[model samples]
Target: MIAPARIRIFVDFWNFSLSLRREDDAFMLDWKPVAGVMVAEASQLLGAPVIYEAMHVYGSYDPAKPADGKFRNWFTTWLDKLPGVHTVMLERQKKRNHITCPQCHGEVKDCPHCHADLRGTEEKGIDTRMATDLVSLAWSNAYDVAIIVSSDRDFVPVADFLQSKGIKVIHAAFPPAGSQLSQRCWGNFNVINLMDKFRR
Candidate 1:
């Protein structure tokens, strides 16, 4: 008898942006339900363990801290933490942080050119590198495939290099691929299409 295979899976908190961009330019924040479903389905299809870098609410400048005014140092999204109703969401970001690597980790002041929060003007794709380094560490072990769910082209180089190293990119996009994404794929799958079928 042969053993079954296990692939590693990861999701981008930012992938939802492309999904919404499929229909509109603005990013949607309430795709939680959609994202949750995407995770379960991807794992089953790929036969792998999956990871979801916690959701983040940052772009351009910290909305809580406007430019023309005083700097909000506390970085507290909530006005108060009395009941602690939303502490989990707040703490998830408050706990850990990263420097100039647009990691899906916590937010920080960086440069856009280097994913740095410098001057507070880093566009989304400008600074982010994938948070899959831990997964890569695991790769030092033994894994056959790695699946990443994101549409950000910044990951193109990383994905290309991984493929070069014999890793399979299950480039899972939410809204489907535009020309920018299709050009760099050995294979691609859309979770939107998967969910439509999975729900049935």
Candidate 2:
């Protein structure tokens, strides 16, 4: 009998979570069951029992934001109880960028009447951190198969690299708009379609 593949899962938390919300506002995710289904599906695809190696979820949280910080803490605590699941939280770095009117191309620092600052806050480093971890794990021979639960095209290059190294990279994505990462991966699965089977 052929040996089962060792599989590791990498999830870009914010990207995957927000994408799911965008895809179906009524949808809710239950991670443990989702992981189980993913492992089962991957095992079937490989035609052998698949071993669950590790599942890493990456994201950032801002402590200054009470609501976000509270949720992050609670969510990470829940994730900690799940087998083989690890959560990596980074401090959310905020940058203030001026917003401009599309037609006028003029800085809109504040609403003339409302006096509200038109500054936009952007989160940085999440994608870079995820990519670094993905490559580092591949170099360390962490798993024979890597399942990525994200739809970001930024991961396309990493997927290509893993494939070149003979590592099976599988893209698990939502529908309506699949990603370039899926196209570059050795195989792909529609996560949205499978959500019902794993829904809490």
Which pairs of residues clash in candidate 1, taking residues 3 or more apart in a chain or in different chains? 102-128, 109-117, 110-116, 110-117, 110-118, 111-116, 111-117, 111-118, 115-127
lDDT of 2 by residue, 146-180 (tens): 99988878888888888899999888877555567
Error of 2 at 65 (Å): 2.1
Which 10-residue window of candidate 2 scores lowest in summed lDDT?
117-126
> Highest lDDT among the candidates is held by which one?
2
What lDDT tens digits, residue by residue, belong to model 1 across residues 83-160? 211111111122133444456755456555787334422234322433344145346844444455666676677667
Identify the runs in model 2 with alpha carbons over 4 angstroms from their true place: 110-117
* TM-score for all models, in order of appearance: 0.46, 0.89
Model 1 weakest lDDT span, ten residues long: 84-93
Clashes of each: 9, 0
